[model samples]
Target: MHLEAFLYGGVSAVLAELASYPIDTCKIRLQVQGQVTDDALTAIKYRGTLHTLMSVCSEEGFFSLYNGFRFAALRQATYGTLRFGIFFSIKRMWNDRGGTDKNLPFLIALGTTAGVTASILTTPIDRMKVLSQSTAQTRKRKIVNTFKKTHSKGGISGLYQGIWPNAKRAAAVNGAEIPCYVFVKDFLTNTLGLEDNMLTQFYCAVTASAVGICISQPFDTAKTRIMQQKTHRTDIRVYEGFFDMCRLTISNEGRRALWKGAFPAWCRNGPWNIVFYLVMERFRKFDQWANQRDHSYF
Candidate 1:
C-alpha cells in the first residue's frame, strides 16, 4: 500500500510538474529578477508572469520556458513521493488507531513532518532546479554540467545551497496545503453532504493551493535568491541567512517584495495541486477496482 502510494504520488507529481513547468520557470525568473544586477538598466527583464512568458518565448524561444524541466521533475519525484506517501501512511496509521481523518491538528502535524523530511532529502534537486532556471547564467547548461560546476566550487555542500530556506518553504506549503485540503474535503463531504467526486476534490485542491501559496511565497522568494547566489564570491553574497534575506528584501524592495513571484507561484501551485489530487484520486480508485476484481476472480 505504501509503495503504491509512493508510485502514484510520484507519477501524479511529475505530470503536475510537466504541465506547470512554464509557470514555475516564470516564478523563479521573477524571484531572481532584481538580484541579477543592481543596475536598473538591466535589472528588470521579467516584469510579471505574462511578460516573462512572452519575453522568454520571443527571446529565448518557447522551449526555454521549460528550462530546468529535468530537475523540476526530479524534485517532484523524490519530494512529492516522500510527502504524499508518508502522509498517506501516517493517516492510515491514525485511522487504524481509531483516529478520524477529520482531526485537523493531526493532519497538519503529519503533513509538516512529511514535508520537512521530503524537503531536506530533495534540497539538492531543488537547488539545481532554481539555479538552472535563474537568469544569472545566460546560457542553458545541462544538469550534469551544473552539478559538476557546483561540486567543483564547494564540494558536495554546494549542491544544497539554500536547503534551510527551501525546507522551511516546503514545510509551510505542505503544512498548509495538506491540512486545508483534508479539512475542506471533509467539510464538503460531511457537512455539505457532497459526494466524493471530481468537483469536491477540485474545490478542495483550489482552496489548499491558495492557502499554501500565500503562506509559502515569502520563503520561496528567499530560497530562490539564496540558491541563485554565486557561492564562490564572499564579497558578492547577497543574503547572509534566511532572516537576513528577508530583512534585505523588505528594507530594499519594500514589504511586498517578499512576494515577488506570488502571481506566478499561484499559477504554478494551483494547477499543479489540482492535477496532483485529481490524478492521485484516480489512481486510488483504479487500485481499488483492480483489487476488487482480483478478489472476486480468486
Candidate 2:
C-alpha cells in the first residue's frame, strides 16, 4: 500500500508538473523579477503572466518555458513520493485508530510534517529548478552543471541554499492545501451531501489551491530570490538571509511584492492540484482493486 502510494504520488506529480510547467516558469520569473539587480530591464521584463509567457517565448523561444523540466520532475518524483506516501500512511493510521479523517487539526499536522520531511531531500532539486527558471541565467544549463557551479561557488552547503525558506513554504503550502482539500471534500460529501465525483473534486481542489497559494506565496517569493542569488564573492548578495530578504522586499517593493507572482502561482497550482488529486484518487482506487483481486487469487 505504501509503495503504491509512493508510485502514484510521484507519477501524478510529474504529470501535473508537465501540464503546469509553463505557468510555473512564469511564476518563478515573476517571483525573482528585479531581485537580480536595480537594472530596469530585469525590473520590467515580465509584466504579468501573459506578458511573461510571450516575452519568454519571443526572447528565449517557446521551449524555454520548460527550462527546468527535468529538475521539476526529479523534485516531484522524490519530494512528492515522500510527501504523499507519508501523508497516506498517517491517514491510514488515523483511520485504524478510529479517528475521523476529517479532523482538520490532525490533517494539517500530518500534511505539514510530511511536507517538511520531504523538503530535506528535495531542496537541492528545488534550488536547481529555481535557478533554471531565473532570468539571471540567460543561457540554458544542464542540471549537473548548475549543481557543480553552485558547489564550486559555495561548497556542498550551497546546493541546499534557501532550504529554510523552501521547507517553510512546503510546510505552509501542504498545511493549507492538503487539509483544506480533505476537509472541503469531506464537508461537501457529508454535510452538503455531494457525491464524490469530479465536480466535488474540482471544488475541493480550487479551494485548496486558493488557500495554499495565499499562505505560501510570500515564502515562495523569498525562496526563489534566495536560491537564484549570485553566490560569487565579488558579486553583491542582495539579501543576507530569509528574514532579510523579506525585509528588503517589503522596504524596496512594498508589502504587495511578497505576492508578486500570486496570479501565476494560481495558474500553476490550481489546475495542478485539480489534476493531481483526481489522478491520485484514481490510482488509489486502482490499487485497491488490484489488492482485492490479488487476495481473491490467493
What local distance difference test score does each model get?
0.84, 0.85
The predictions' CA RMSDs to the true structure, in order, are 3.1, 2.9
Candidate 1: C-alpha lDDT: 0.84
Displacement of the residue 50 alpha carbon in candidate 1, Å: 0.7
Worst 10 residues of 1 by lDDT: 33-42
- 1-298: candidate 2 lDDT, tens digit per residue: 4577778888999999999999999998888776544352255577899999999998889989999888999999999989988887778767766877579999999999999999978999999998788764567778788788888888877998888988999999988998899899989998989998888999999999999999999989988988877666454555677799888888878899999899999999999999999988777667769777431100
- For model 2, give the RMSD to the true fold: 2.9
RMSD in Å for model 1: 3.1
Candidate 1 residue-wise lDDT, 111-188, digit = tens: 889999999999888988987787634677777888898889977778888889988988899889988998898889
TM-score of each candidate structure, all chains considered together? 0.93, 0.94
